[model samples]
Target: MRAARFRPGACLVLALVAVLAGGTQQASAETSPNLAIDAPPSAVVMTAPLDPSPGTLLTFSVAVTPGTNPTSTGLYVNCDLSWLGLGPSAPLFDDGTNGDPTAGDLTFTVQATIPSGTKPGTRLGDCGVFDAESRSASTSYSVNVVPAATDVGPSVTDTVPLSDATDVATDANVTITFSEAVDATGSWYALSCASSGDHTASVTGGPQSYLLDPGTDFAAGELCTVTVTA
Candidate 1:
């Protein structure tokens, strides 16, 4: 996961390099970056939309600042990655070290691939940033994902039993086809029988058709009307 929030229209560039505890060397970074974790705001889950999919290749970064407290094992971190279509990284921690801001900040990189079966929506996870001595601080993260949208509306295509045709048979189901997926979410149309005799009508069938079947048969040698309205 990325430590910095992904801002829309902002360049998403990061640098992370895993390193074991060792003596300090000349830092590659020219200028140090701000602390990834702050007390007041308190670092939490990120807001950037990774837009992850199955087999998605992702890379991110994190920052660990130097303080008076330094543990032998370095820092410890906990975060939720299962919901992000991946698992946690190995030994989440960083050794306390300070590099001149003019010399650049020490940035660490994290990379992973999104697993299959991740759905399109908001995913939340936990993130814990522990101090060098194993003192733990935790936060939550959120990732919003959405699928590509194609703008297309549904329309009526064909209707059964041509209107105003004579000798229309009774005890038959009226099937209507649609141009696109209609009422896919839920019921968006109604079917009713409007004629001399009492009849019941309902919206039925798959996304395309609205099968209007009358509960009672049509009268003999009499005109009957059926209406389908959205």
Candidate 2:
């Protein structure tokens, strides 16, 4: 048999293969871009100090980092003043647009008025951030309110003592001063003598003060103590 001669088409196909292989090697040498967001250690952190008085203005902020531009983002706060248990539910105040998720490194402000007549103690509330382009993030915080202290004990600022040795009594009437003006019908005073037992207590004149009438006689030249519990 005579040796057969191959066509030039084979050489062209081999050349094309060499070109494709070179292109693939070049592509593998290129670097890629980072398409992820650097979220904070804590998605939500305390942004402001708590209010000290009821009805005081409270402001806070939230920080977020989305791997990509979000389609929509906003904040919502849940306030619970249920401790009062006598009025409407606590209201939420927001300062950011509800639906715009295409932005990055966004800061939002939330303001709320502490409900009036809130009890004096630590109040808890929660906040959350939602990015329609991503997921929902949330946090919680506490607000502390100091109680108003009022004097609810007796005073002799405007009382006169009986004269004459024989007419003078060892026992004296006690008075009380309330920290705040309270309803006389709803408020009462309690008095207990160290030496004697429970004594009768009464509210006289205005709603802010109370007078205690001694139920038992006191010994002369003896030390006596009275406690007014509100």
Candidate 3:
């Protein structure tokens, strides 16, 4: 007899990195030997929601000092979140669109979706300016990716070795998959062998998947109960 059990685990709060790209108004950037490399904004002020949930459509705004840069074709926010398993890079605009208050103002803004499955935490990235010649310089910034005020814990979506499996292989490993990435910081698991008494297994795997390997094979003809607590 082989049985499987699941216990809800604590939620791990991570961030959604947003990479800022070139604005639409900016002239096509081309390399030029005489192009002047504008200095990064003398000041960078980013504006974002206090608490944004996954899949939420939100506006990110960045205001910089010296709104007037004669040599600058446009300004932009440069950052990346793909490393965090989230959405790709996007641009922040100063053209009075995408939530910008005024066109030509140093205040750049863009409306973007917070990729679904993004964990809750502070997401950090960079911001900068670009010349028509494609030269750029940037400064750092951070945004808080928060969960909804009314939030729920991660749930089990599926598992390996379907529940109540019989005649299971002695060396079969157990795997658990979740609806969302789990914290697994203080998680644990156990393998109870009816004939061999208590048994232990090593736990491994990731943000949404977990694997369990027993130290030794299970008894040939005995009840094996595997319990996992996320």
Estimate, for each residue in 133-154, the C-alpha lDDT of model 2 and write its tens digit. Answer: 4455556666677654453654
- Backbone collision tally, model 3: 5
Question: Residue 27 lDDT in model 3?
Answer: 38
Model 2 bad stretches (over 4 Å): 1-27, 31-51, 54-67, 70-117, 149-230
Ranking by TM-score: 3, 1, 2
Q: TM-scores of the models, in the given order?
A: 0.34, 0.33, 0.40
**Could you say which candidate leads in lDDT?**
3
Residue pairs with backbone overlap in model 3:
9-230, 19-79, 20-77, 20-79, 21-90
Model 2 clash count equals 9
**After superposition, which runs of candidate 1 have C-alpha atoms over 4 Å from their true positions?**
1-49, 66-73, 88-108, 148-230
Residue-level error in angstroms, candidate 2, position 3: 49
Lowest summed lDDT over 10 consecutive residues: which window, candidate 1?
A: 14-23
Tens-digit lDDT track for model 3 on 1-230?
88886444422221111112343223345542475444534446465565677877766666665433354455565444452343456566778887888998777787677777888888776656555546566667676777766667788787787777888897888888889998765546667888887666687898889887878888787887766674
For model 3, what is the error of residue 205's alpha carbon versus the real structure, in angstroms, after optimal superposition?
A: 56
- Candidate 2 has its poorest 10 consecutive residues by lDDT at 156-165
